[model samples]
Target: MKIARLSSADIHWCEDGDPQGVPVVFANSLGTDLRLWDKVIELMPKQGLRLIRFDKRGHGLSSCPPGPYSMEDLVEDTRELLKVAGVHSCIFVGLSIGGMIGQLLASRQPSLVQGLVLSNTGAKMGEAAMWQERISSIRAGGIDALADAILERWFSGKFRQSDECLAWRHMLTRTPVEGYIGCCEAIAGTDLTASTSKLDLSVIGIGGADDLASPPELVRNTAALVAGSRYVEIAAAGHLPCVEQPHQFAGHLMTFFKEDLHVTKV
Candidate 1:
């Protein structure tokens, strides 16, 4: 466990595998924290890789400054953390909001990003009104009220009925309300189309077959924005494929890293 204490916020993070090995940084989704990647990390090839996972501001053990955060702020926080941790370059893997962060990071600090993976996310999420409504609902009743609907969008119906869903629901509901709302505000304002389109790095976009939050078409379109990006869809999974299908998810990532990024070259 580690904490990157930035001027803006304190970021809680965890790392595994060799410190001197290939570096891979992971940013989680909106509601979940670093733990969201536990299953995927367990199944990933562990030799010669330094895996770093961080809880975004307002999620997990990271500090919640206030409401109405900006996409730039989130991006800056990640930049600061990487600098503080002595990471010169890495293969950045981001899910949902985390994916959005990667788009920004690769554009802003190209030298630091060797390859990019955008999973279960879009360049632009929803309209301002929709995010405002979600924020209002959270303020009125807390995140618990949105857990059921969120889980439905996150996992398939059959998975929703299983015990595994219970843990995810708990994670969603336990998220700090301020953090959730702040990220909602950020997502509402972010439109990464311009930045993502201009990126020239090795990139791959992964979507779940059953994902409703960011459908396959949307994820594919985002991938299309980049010149040579690849796309893949995992079967029977929802928004968080890394959770419901860890091995499959990890396989897609490994293929990208080994083939595209050429881990040996790094």
Candidate 2:
């Protein structure tokens, strides 16, 4: 297992494809680990790319620090992880809270990110009060309490009936309470509207037609913040389109790499 021992936390990370190939770093959504990108990675071209993925501070095998983490903390952890992994510049693909991290990181350290893909996320995820309420509920009853509702938002009704949905439910309910709450607090405190609007890099915003967490309009609006960003919505999918519709999602990513970033091999 690959690990980056950052000052604040030990981040679990993994890389695929050539080390010298063009870099593409992926950041996971809340309550998920690096494996969140497994299906998408499998569909990607086998050559000429270095795909990096990591578990955020408190999720997956990473150590849980404490509750109420900040967005700055998450961004710094990712920054350090990239440095340790020897990535100088790369396209960043972020989902949900991961997308928020990509926005802040690109804003603060523009030289580090060359392109961005924001998937099923918003500049401001939700109101602080709503996050606080969810946090309280989790604290009182653990992550299992909200697993059903969260899964509903994550996948469409047809997917919810499939056996694969049970595995996602397990991933959700198994997330550490403190870790989940910490991310919730971080999401609650972040608002990337102004920062994201100032970004000049190439960007693509992807949304799921069935997404209830961050609707298609919200994702499109966030993408519109960038001067020349593009937006696409996937049908029959929800918040985690990479999981629900990997083939279509991967196609969009490959197109962005080739057309916008001018990546020929990937």
Candidate 3:
């Protein structure tokens, strides 16, 4: 792991060196760190590719600044991360709330992005009413009130019952309440309906068939709004597709980047 400050706090990330491959930045969900991508990263063919993963401002080993960080702030934070890493334009891959950040960032600064991969997220996200209620609940009660609910949404009941992946759910349990609420604010204010219509970049949208967190239907609708974006739904997976089914996720990911698109991993 490497560390750099985006603003007042130090941001942390892990890098897989592949100078010849396309530079790809992967952002984790709201509460998790760069480690969230471990399973998926394990499957990707390095083949001289550069891979980057980062803990958002409030997650992982990163510092949790004050409350109510905006989506734009998150975008800028990512921009700085890329700049510091000497990345020019790169593919932006995001999951869950991370996907929301990717949408806004790609829209706000198209020059900084070469391609986009959005998973387990929607353009409009939840209804404004529901997000408002969630924000209130999180702020008032804490992340504990939402941890089990989120864990449940992210994985299947069978997964929870089995010890297939306890670490993933455990990470959610370890999230700080303040950080969760701050990210909740970011999610609440997020809406990329207009941005999706105008993006002029390569995009591959994906979601899990059984994702309660962000359904495939929602992801399909999001892809529909993106003009010509292709969509995929991993069967028998949940919100965290990469973890639930790593090989399948990698197959979809590699096909999207290398075969379908001319992403020249050189």
**Using lDDT as the measure, which candidate wins?**
2
Model 2 lDDT per residue over 70-130, tens place:
9999999999999998888989999999999999999999999999999999999999999
Instruction: Please give the CA lDDT of all the candidate structures.
Output: 0.92, 0.94, 0.82
* Stretch of 10 with least lDDT, candidate 1: 257-266
Per-residue lDDT of candidate 1, residues 1-266 (tens digit): 78899999999988987788889999999999999999988877667889999999999999998877999999999999999989999999999999999999999999999999999999999789999999989899999988889988999888998998998889899888999999999999999999899999998999999998999898999988999899999999999999989999999988998899888632
Runs of candidate 2 exceeding 4 Å displacement? none
Candidate order, TM-score descending: 2, 1, 3
Ranking by lDDT: 2, 1, 3
Q: Which pairs of residues collide in model 3?
A: 18-49, 21-48
Which candidate number would show the highest TM-score if scored against the true structure? 2
**lDDT of candidate 2?**
0.94
Residue 244 of candidate 3: its Cα lDDT?
Answer: 79
lDDT of 1 at 166: 96
Each candidate's number of clashing pairs is 0, 0, 2
For each candidate, give its TM-score against the true structure. 0.98, 0.99, 0.94
lDDT of 3 by residue, 1-266 (tens): 68977775578987885866778899888778888788888777777568899898878888888878888888888888888999888888899888888888989889888788889888877876787788788778776678778878888777777775567767876776677778888888878899877887778888898899898988888877776788988887889888778788878777777765576643
Give the Å error, residue 118, model 3: 0.9
